[model samples]
Target: MTTLLNVTLTPDQRDLLEVIAAPWLARGEWPLWANVQHHFDMRGEDADAIFHSLPRVGTQTPFGAGYGFTLPMRAPVDGKDRVRLTVAASLVVPKVRPVGEQFVQALQHMIHLYTSRPMHFDQVPTIILRSEELEEALPDLPVWFFDVLPDLLSNEPTIITGGVHTSRRAWEREVTRSVLQYRRVQSVEGYIEKTCEIVVAAAAQYGPAIAVAATVAAEPERSPYIDAGLLAELETAAATNRWKVHKLIALCQGLNDAYIAENPYACAAMIRSILDHIPPVFGHTDFKHVAAQHVFSMKRNDKTHAQRLAAFKDIADDVMHRPIGHTTPRISMDDLPEPIRLNAILNEVVIVMPKSAPPTT
Candidate 1:
């Protein structure tokens, strides 16, 4: 029988589904009620209610006492959210029958393979038979059965397997090899745990100051003094060794904020601080050494840019050490170092720094 189902969800529910469904959607697999329960942190009955509320397609295996259901899920594609259908099959077994741990592990392994790569097809076929006997005794079922089976399957019983289209066979083979050999963080939970540890460590190290600066830096407005792309490169380089560059990133953020606010004195001081902070990245003890000795090969005007930056140090010193007098001193936006000079130094830093190496298996 054919059926059409439509589900309407609240904005919050849709957002939650977007997160819970991402990995399953990426693999073109429908999440079972148990998967939904884990992600949503809901009780079994509630998860079942929600799962059944969504649209589904149902079928039974021709050769075995197996039945399955497929669900339609939403995911973002080409910058727009779209709904796609996914298939999954399971056997009907007596409640007294105990599923083996080996079977459970094989299913998990297959899922890990599917999720570790980018989406290859709009739908992946899946079949979960009852036992090895059932899989071995299987006959050639109708074409529709192949249409509903998964691409990557564990061969060892309880056997899971699927047929792939000719176009996808090559990709499937490569994916299988790479995923089996190089995959790290075996499960989704392990990956999440590692990510949380990194975040917590960063929070403890940078404290609230860097966090606040990051928030300010994320604003849409471009800073007149700092090139955002160059700053991002510096941030990436620093991320490899955060203790060395946390202050530098914060200084850049403060400088950008000061320039946007037209606080010329603050801008001068921050620029001076940044010049003082980044010399070590270039293997120099001080900014003066960086300015005088560091070779700039990208452009002919780089020496002149370095000279201008060196001059700004003196200007900033005047702003910082000039004693308060009966007559107040004046500093204007024009007095700040030219952006080109600072950008030249930043570009050199990005070019000189070693990038973080890719993680190894």
Candidate 2:
């Protein structure tokens, strides 16, 4: 999923952006360095330094001007080490403005090239100007890093070529001819505008999905008893391999899922599994011994909870091993053990687990 990093500019930065964007706002032309110097009343050298210092968007090498800002981000790719990405966008325009289809294709081509290359260039949706009417609308230029996930464009092939040819030289010549044909039919301004529109629409459509995925990622598994934070702590402890709590974690998650689905039988079975699994953490082969002998280190209420948890095993066994009779058996949410009882036991396990070793530099 892609992440949107909102960029907030200082007052001075805002003023500087206005100076850079003035020419485009007035006449749809790229601003000159001289215009910035005149607006700021600075000398040529000083203006040049300031202009270059700013995080610019669009082609700057040949002194082309476009709206938006450059934001640098460190993000992980395909489970590998994090790489630095330089993200940029063009100026936003109203939706009513006509943008050609060819422009969208061209922009997508550029996106594919930049992202696949060693020098990562990430592009996001353009700033959208929200207004009832174009004549009365004010430009809403917000800067942000819109992370485009690799999977979003993974299906698009890097190279497009003509039909199979007998020789490599023939294929290369055919591809060159196609490229020249495409260039002859494309429009520069229309391509830029359409690219911005497509990006804006994509962001709008996928924003909610990305947010939900991010929330799920932040908390791998959650239940009433095991929240995201507690689960994280348990994971950290388990990583050391000293606690041997991986099965305990899985059981806890199973219990949570069963409880949520209102399957009292499954919930009871999961609780029994958890009871049988965590005794080793307390230096006992059986839960009954742990419950009887391990309460001295715990607080009064926690000790009571632990004892109650031990008693719950009988109820869970009855639910799991009971035989079918003439009368039908029924179970409900009330038949399950209290969430706090499990929470107390898990908390104690975390307290006793060894801390993971620190990473070496």
Candidate 3:
């Protein structure tokens, strides 16, 4: 998997990915099992159950089928069936911090698992995971962090609203003191000796190119790699770690201490891997023709009736717009806090930037 993504996902992405993968796994279609069976020469059903366990499969919409995920083989894909396919879609946001990191793990895992199981999700079927629950599902964090804290990806592109709007970041000196400081530090003091060694050695022993990369990542002017080309180059550099370079690249782009302290090797490695596999996914659109029926209702106003069309907006605002930082009992931001934040913050700083073209002829 690291060979493919090079660590494009941060922590929150891993969380979302776990939830995203739950649906298919619950249905006994986990490609991960197939992958395991292929390597270990295990029984089909036995391998299936282990890989499809509750902790793994139940991560999907557990209560019932058809929670929030969009599937291609079901309604939207096939028009011949009356009963919808027994596939459920769901993702539980963690109540703890480290938001985006979860999604990154899940994303990388799911994609890698997909290569093993081609029939379940279809060869890149029309699938869209709903991120709305995440908006209201965050833990009960204060509004202060909310203001400066970067918002995760919304319906829009990789644009984060309601923050100082930085292109790149470095571990702020303060994060070492804050709760986020414990990032990947195996030692209690919150130190990432291996991470610093790699970066310093890469800069000092390797060549001037890495030195320039190290310096540029911490630059005040959003680093010189604000352009797309340089970001790709950075990802290539980080991919050398293969385990966590994406996390490192994110850390470099964002200097949050918690993020840095944790998984310095993995982060740096992921960057290099993703760089090697730049422009990873190309989304193709799919159209569904099922559920031919249309929904119609009467419109009313003045808060007197339940069918008030005008009240739809108000009701939605009250219900749908839950505050961020809330917890998810089973899964959430804190499961791997630092990695998640690193993924989110660094994604903003590194992955989505528009690169400047090299000097043209």
Task: Name the regions of candidate 3 deviating beyond 4 angstroms.
Answer: 1-22, 30-339, 354-361
List pairs with backbone clashes in candidate 1: 125-149, 125-150, 126-149, 126-150
Model 2 clash count equals 1
Clashing pairs in 2: 103-191
Clashes of each: 4, 1, 69
Ranking by TM-score: 2, 1, 3
Task: Tell me model 2's lDDT, rounded to 2 decimals.
Answer: 0.45
Better of 2 and 3 by TM-score: 2
Q: How many pairs of residues collide in model 3?
A: 69
Which candidate order results from sorting by lDDT in descending order?
1, 2, 3
List RMSD in Å for every model shown.
20.2, 20.2, 26.7
TM-score of 2: 0.37
User: What range of 10 consecutive residues in model 2 has the weakest lDDT sum?
Assistant: 143-152
lDDT of each: 0.46, 0.45, 0.26
